[model samples]
Target: MNVYLGLGTNLGDKEQNLCRAVQKIEERIGKIVSLSAFYATAPWGFQSDNSFLNAAVCVETSLPPYEVLKETQQIERRMGRNYKSVGGQYKDRVIDIDLLLFGDIVMNEADLVLPHPLMTERRFVMEPLAEIAPDLVHPVLGQTMKELNA
Candidate 1:
């Protein structure tokens, strides 16, 4: 299965964190097929001091969605993520990895959401995604990146 992932870092060594994340991802998960260019953007949730360094990765993975998610969380922790604040989305330290899409699969579970609930709205995600696969369609919305960006 080919999957799209969102990567972001706002705390400490943003660029290195993202780069190391890519390496770790390719090391743990299946091979990385495509990777979007690095993008600098403002923090999305709670106002923060550091702007986020963001990018997207497309990888070929045979792992199931939940297992993939679990592995990603583990990677985040290995990179120094602290999941202390159990609540609505907020910024955190080190690397933040989100499983955006799992080969067009639509899932709305307590722990995961496929095609990323806010992927379309955020230019940070959309821009990088468009950079790599502008023709990629939203499985549920039936809209391509070009269509959505237009």
Candidate 2:
């Protein structure tokens, strides 16, 4: 399966954090096919003094969606990411790895959602995603990442 992931970091050696996370992903999950240029964006759905550095990655994984999510979460934990929120607020973190898309599969479970629920609204995700996968259409929205980025 071809998976697209959104990587963001606002705390600690931002670029290195992303590089290390991608390295770990390749080592544990699967091979990385492509990676987008890094982008800096303001925090969405919350406030934070540290702006987030975000990028998109495409990896070919044999693991199923749920397994992908599990491995990615483990990667985050290994990267020193902690659930940093106070009273339901998002905060700066060492790393955040979000599963943006998994092939054309659309799923909604308590623990996971495919095509990511908020990728369209967040330029941080769309921009980098478009960079790498401009023609990859969202199964739910039926639009290409380039269109969504617009």
Candidate 3:
């Protein structure tokens, strides 16, 4: 399965955090097929003193969605992610790795959601994602990443 992931960091060696997280993902998860350039953006959904450096990557994995989520969380913890979002508001963090797509699968559960619910609303995610996957369709929205960004 081809999985798309969104990565971001706003604290503690931002570039290094992104790179390390990608390395960990490759080491523990599966092969990385494509990666997008890093993009700097203002923090979304909350106030923050530091802006974020965000990027996206496409990985080919055989693990199921839940297993992929588990591995991603483990990677985040390994990279010093210590706090979860409060009141659905974002905050500065060492690293944030979001699973954006899993081969056109759509899932919604208490702990995870495929085709991330808020991806279209955030330029940080859409921009990097569009760069690497402009024609990748959202399984639910029925639109390409480039169209969504437009």
Candidate 4:
């Protein structure tokens, strides 16, 4: 399976945090096929003095979607993230690894959502995603990443 992931950090050594997360993902998830350049952006949802360093990654993995989510969450926790954003309230963190897309699958389980629910709406995600997978289409939206990014 080909999966897309969005990585971000603002609470620590931002570049190192992203690099470490990418390394761990390769170790735990699968081989990374494509990776975008790091982008620095302001916080999205909530007020934060710390800006974010974000990037997107495409990976080839044999793990199922749920397993991918589990591993990503574990990666976040191991990297010093204490909790996930609740009720759409975001915060600055050491690392955030979001499972953006799992192949062309569309799922809305309580714990996971494929073609990530808010991916298209966030420039931080779409910009990097488009950079690496410009022609990749969103199964639900039926548009290419580059188009969506526009």
Candidate with maximal lDDT? 4
Candidates arranged by TM-score, highest first? 4, 3, 2, 1
Q: Give TM-scores for every candidate, taking all chains together and pairing residue i with residue i.
A: 0.94, 0.95, 0.97, 0.98
Give candidate 4's whole-model lDDT.
0.94
Q: Candidate 4, residues 73-119: lDDT per residue as tens digits?
A: 99999999979999998888999999999898888888887878999
Residue-by-residue lDDT tens digits, candidate 3, 1-150: 999999999998899999999999999889999999999999998899999999999999999999999999898887788777866877789999998999989889988988898899889999999999999999998999999999
lDDT tens readout by residue for model 1, 1-150: 998898999899899999999998898888999998899999886788889999999989989998888889889999999683357668656888988878989999877889788888888888888888889888999988777766
Best by TM-score: 4
Tell me how far the alpha carbon of residue 86 in candidate 1 is from the true structure, in angstroms, after superposition.
4.5
Global local distance difference test of model 3: 0.92
Candidate 2: list runs displaced more than 4 Å.
84-88
Off by over 4 Å in 4: none
lDDT at position 20, candidate 2: 96
